[model samples]
Target: MDHPLLLAFGLLLVVEGLFPLLAPQAWKDTFSRLIGLRDGQLRTIGLIGVALGVALLVSFS
Candidate 1:
């Protein structure tokens, strides 16, 4: 509760766990498709996630 970085990482783990816990097959299928994506496509998706996270941090914090 006192450490923001630790709390954020913990929350991330919870969020990351949801898909597999809720639908393991779907999660596996999604990753299989993601594995087939080009490197640029994966980079773009990662960039989008980073951008969204930064935007949310700026807006909320």
Candidate 2:
């Protein structure tokens, strides 16, 4: 169980890290646009995604 969690984390890190190296300018532009998003809006969107993910996981488990 722990091994799978660690593997997931490692995969996330690798994908996230590679994006910047592979597309630095695109990442910068995208992040700048993301930063323009209002805090409340971002939080709401994030919460919705988290909630959906949790529901799916719970149902699957």
Candidate 3:
């Protein structure tokens, strides 16, 4: 596709689906644990993930 954002989102979907598709039970367990985490803890995790993604993109580019 000509749109880089669209392609990136599509790839993201594929990667995100892999865990659930390959090991549904494990995914369910992990999700259950995630649900128990506090909002602050989840926000921290999300921030770290975003930071890592940005770092990777910066390094590659």
Candidate 4:
């Protein structure tokens, strides 16, 4: 795409889809475990993901 935002979003989709595409069972298993996690734990995981994503975007761009 002509826009950097579109390019980044497309890359994000590709990366997000790869794991489930390659290992559907494993992907399901991961979410099954995630379901057992407490809300706080899930929040922490999500926060970390966001932080790292921001860090990577800053460093790369």
TM-score: which candidate is best?
1
Which segments of model 3 are wrong by more than 4 Å?
Answer: none
- The lDDT ranking, best first, is 1, 3, 4, 2
TM of each candidate vs. truth? 0.96, 0.68, 0.89, 0.91
Off by over 4 Å in 4: none
Error of 3 at 51 (Å): 0.3
Give one digit per residue, the lDDT tens place, for model 1 in 23-52.
Answer: 999999999999999999999999999999
Candidate 2, superposed: residue stretches over 4 Å from native: 51-61
Number of clashing pairs per prediction, in order = 0, 0, 0, 0
How well is each residue in 1-61 modelled by candidate 4, as lDDT tens digits?
5799988889889999999999999999999999999999999999999999999989998
lDDT of each: 0.98, 0.89, 0.97, 0.96
Which 10-residue span in candidate 3 carries the lowest summed lDDT?
A: 1-10
Report per-prediction Cα RMSD to one decimal.
0.6, 2.5, 1.0, 0.9
TM-score of 2: 0.68
lDDT of 1: 0.98
> Which scores greater on TM-score, model 2 or model 3?
3
Q: Distance from true position, residue 27, model 1, in Å? A: 0.3
lDDT of 4 at 55: 100
Candidate 1 lDDT for residue 32? 99
TM-score winner, 1 or 2: 1
